[model samples]
Target: MPWGERPRWARWVSVIWIVGFVEGTGAHLLDLISGGLHAYHAWPLPSQVLFHALLVVDLLVAVLVARGLPSGPPLGAAVMVTDLTANYQGNWSGLLHEPLAYVGVTGLLPMTLFGLFVVGTALPLGRAFRGIVRPV
Candidate 1:
């Protein structure tokens, strides 16, 4: 099938990814714009830059994935994992000293799981949606 023609489920997944990318990017941008560098003073300069850069890269990958690029999802997943790690470190309040602090941050876990799901299924999902495999 042509790149424009993809299965409905695949399209839905792509839309979900795009929405996540927008939300994630928007949140970061809002913080930077509204609160400025002081908002991220909790993290080091390099860490802040790295996290934002990764977000931009993830957004680009999301666009490619939405356009049916076969490699996009796995790459996005890797980016998401790295982003998650950065978030964890930035928010770290002594995991060993206060294990409950980790649980206080709920968003990271679900997002990580979703990213893993995308990575695990990317190839088969891409093939299935492109009509390379029959729908089961």
Candidate 2:
């Protein structure tokens, strides 16, 4: 079937994945410059490594987004979960305890966006496949 003839939910899922990857990549670049990543104080070295690793992961997500294939949802799901953990840890590292901590906490915005993307992509994608496999 042609692209347009595909399920509308699938198209929306693709759009969400595309947005997630784009936002993820942009957030990483901003962190590199604005020192926004300092929110991750515990195990600073590993945190930095994970921070950079996400850039690679985001690139992979971008490819999946461009392809708009069924695989995008699962990959985006993984990214969303990872982002949640990372953000939670970063926020709780006592980095946000100081007076000016709000500046660093801004990293959560991308995380929030990631959650939205995951929900947008997964909910509709799940609906698209709801009846695919019948009971044996």
Cα-based lDDT for every prediction: 0.69, 0.63
lDDT of 1 by residue, 31-89 (tens): 77877766667787877886667547767876777677766777777777777777777
- Model 2 RMSD, rounded to 1 decimal: 5.3
TM-score of each: 0.71, 0.64
**For residues 17-124, could you state the per-residue lDDT of candidate 2 as single tens digits?**
666678777777776667765633454576677776777788787676555455556777777787677766766755557635544444565567657768555645
Query: Per-residue lDDT for 115 in model 1?
Result: 70
Worst 10 residues of 1 by lDDT: 101-110
Candidate 2 local lDDT, residue 129: 41
What is the C-alpha local distance difference test score of candidate 2? 0.63
Give me the runs in candidate 2 sitting further than 4 Å from their true place.
33-43, 93-106, 116-120, 123-136
Scored by TM-score, the top model is 1
